[model samples]
Each structure stands twice: as structure tokens, then as C-alpha cells.
Target: MSRRRFTIRRPRGVAEYGAAALVAAAAVSLVVRLLVWVGEVLVRWWPVVAVLALLGIAVGAWRAAAAAREHTARAQRLSVLRFTLAEIDAMDDRQFEFALRDLLIRDGWSARQVGQQGDQAADVIAGHPTYGRIVVQAKHTKVAAKVGSQVMYQVKGTAGPVHRANSAVVVTNGSFTRDAREWGDRHTIGWADRERLRSWAELGVPLHQILQLPTLARRRLPGTRQPFPAPYERTAPEGRTNGVR
Candidate 1:
């Protein structure tokens, strides 16, 4: 018995296969003309066929390049989001509040951190400076932590006179309970959940500027080069205490 060997060719992509088909059809038509006179008909339409084949290849290449570019952009956005989340996780409570405050200010809202020492109900109060104020409760917590209805109630209770401020806003790093969200909806309080916070951070909004309240005094002392120090620092002068030196 004799053994026969055969080789198989792999299929080409759309552009390659289309070009091959166009070439083969032209060659076959020319061959037909040599045997008969039908080749003239094929030759007459050859320019149109070539133009159509080239147009098809160009369209396919454009679509492929567009898809590749879209995937690359999406990957880049994901990379940026990951880095932003890492930074948020690393920030201390103060820093997180500062960042949130700055974001509000950048959005054209005036903000102030209502110190816990006072009868303040919210962590920050923001407004349009001239129109009204919006109470903001900033919660810097781990992923496991959650904001409950009680926090929402407290913010609503502390939002000053209705004539001065129209609404309250609760901002948190972790998600809020369903009950909390329902409470906010019922009371007309705005909830800025973890997703919104993440979005703001991704957009590169500054949170520190929101804490710059006008009533707060700006002071600079020793060990500080800047003319004004952050308002959150201790107000007492250096080396001086309430009683002891």
C-alpha cells in the first residue's frame, strides 16, 4: 500500500480572505475568457469589485481599532479608580473629612466643620454662603461599618432653622442601612453614600477647602511657616495650658 501526504491551509481573516476571493474571481473570469468570450464581462466589472473589496477591508480595520481603543481606555479608568480607593483607605478620619469638605467648597458651597464639642449635630455644615445651609455628617468608617437611622435622625434634628437652611446631607465611606435611606427619603435629607464619595474622589475633587469657615480665626505660630494654620488645630498658644504652664 502507498501512503499519501496532504497539507491543509488555515482560514484567513476577513480582509485577507476577501482579497484572496477578489483575486481568485478575477483570475477565473480571465481564464473563462481564454476558453470563451465571457472574460470581457468580468474584466469590465473588475474595477468596481476591487474598489468594493478595499472599502470592506478599510471598514473592518476601522472597527477593530475603535474596539481596541475603547478597551484600553476602560482599563485606564479602572486603574485610576483602584489608586483612588487605596488613597481613601489610607487617610485618617481628619484627612477624610478635610478631603470631603474641600470637595464641597470646590463645588461652590461654603462649609464648616461643626466641632463635636459644641451642641453641633453634624460634622459639617455647607451652604450657598448667601442662600442657605446644608448639614453634612461625614462618616469615616471601615467597609464593615454602616450608617444607621439614628445618625440620620441626629443630622435632621440639628439642621438649624428652616428659614436659614433648606436641607441636610449625610456623607459616609460605608453604605447606609435601608432603614436609614428610607428615613432620609421620608425626611427629605440628601444621602451621599459610599459610591457617590468614591465618584467625587475619582473626579479629583478637593475635600479640605470645605472646612474653611469664615467665622473661624486664622492663626500662625512658631514651627509653622505659613501665615495661617489649619483651623482644626488647638487654639491655645504654645506652652500655655488652661491652668498649667
Candidate 2:
């Protein structure tokens, strides 16, 4: 048996064939010249090129690692915030009020709880730097339930005559209605909306750390009574995916 040989066919026209061969030869020659030039450059400046290449690789790797770490940290913070939000929603009225008041105190306010009887709809009274005495009404609700105009009216009315507050603030673990927000904007009422609450939850030893495990108690360090686990474990809430979407 004879083996058939494969061959590349050329253009039949003489000028066309010559042009194609010349183009192909030129491309090959250019590639050869580029390779020779690269080799010569490398041989002449190998030390500098090697150092620069290593430096470039190191920089690229470092930047990539830094970006990845930042992304991971951001994801962890978001997770913690979401869990804290769910925990806030899970809180009862009194718990929610106290937490909000505590957050106020963390921000350098002399916050007091006044949500009991005769409190006049004011859950917290805070000494603001600018507003002097400010009142906050807390509403911890489902994400979809918006704080309506009635709540705003109560906020204004109770804060004005009853508490003699300088600023009436409406804080919610959820969101605010358009009318409620509009009224607040018009009346110079401060609002700690869900995003603000979420930001608060990201603070040191935040509500995420205070959350009860299945036993309705804070997850404590194994050897000690500390609510936080090891530093790494503290970054993520354990066994809870039912957080904000």
C-alpha cells in the first residue's frame, strides 16, 4: 500500500500566487525579526527585565490578593449586618426600643428609655449635639411593612408637646412610607431607616454578637463567658441564612 502525501495548493493566477507567497513570506519574516529582536533585548537587559517582571508579578499578585481579601471582608460584613437585622426584627417591642437606645448611647448620646406608660410615643430621648434633646420612636417590623404617616404624626405630636424635644426622629428596623419620609423631610425630622440600622449593626460587638443561639442565649467563647468566639469566627454568624436578601 502506497501512502498519499498531503500538499498545500497555491493560487492558479501567477500574480495572485506571487502576492500570496510574498505576503506569507513577509509575515514569517516579520515574526522571525520580532523573535530575534525580543531575544536580543532579553539577552542585553535580562537582569533589569527579570527584576521588572518579578516585580510586576508580585505587584499583580499582591493587588489581586488585596482585592480578594477586601471582597471577602465586605461579604462577611454584609452577612453580619443581615443577620443582625433579622435579629432586630425578631426582637420584641421592648427589646427593639432598648437596642435602638443603646445604639444612640454608642454614638455619644445620653439616651434614655421612655417607652412605658405616659411616655407619649417616645421610645428614646437622646441629647443630640445640635438638636439638644431629641426623641426617637422605634418601629421594628417586617421588611415590607413601611412606617406610615400616622407614625410620623405621633412622632411629631409626642415629641413636640409631650417631650418638648428639639428634633423628632423616627427609627425603624424596616423602611418608611413615602408620606412618612416626605413629612419628615418637610418637618426636619431625622430618620434612622433600615440602611442606617444596618450600618449601626456593623459597629464593634454589634447586635450580631448579641444574637441568641438556638438556646436563645448569646454564643459565648468556649473557655470564657465572652459573647464572641475566636476573632475569625466572630466575622460570620453561625447557622442562620434567613437574613436580608
TM-scores of all predicted structures:
0.47, 0.49
Top candidate (lDDT): 2
Tell me the deviation in Å of residue 172 in model 1: 0.8
Indicate the TM-score of model 1.
0.47
The candidate that wins on TM-score is 2
- At residue 108, candidate 1 shows an lDDT of 51
Model 2 worst lDDT run, 10 consecutive residues: 228-237
The runs of at least 3 residues in candidate 1 whose Cα sits more than 4 Å from the true structure, single-residue gaps closed, are 1-83, 129-131, 162-164, 204-245
lDDT on C-alpha atoms for all candidate structures: 0.60, 0.66
Q: Write the per-residue lDDT of candidate 1 for residues 66-117, one digit (tens) a residue.
A: 9797567545544433225566666666656555555555455566555365
lDDT for each residue of candidate 2 in 1-245, tens digit (9 for 90 to 100)? 99999997768898988999999999999999999999999999999999999999999999999979756755655553333777787877777776666665544456666687777778877654333566778888888788888888877777768766666777788898888888877876767678877766543333222321012232332345533211211111234332334
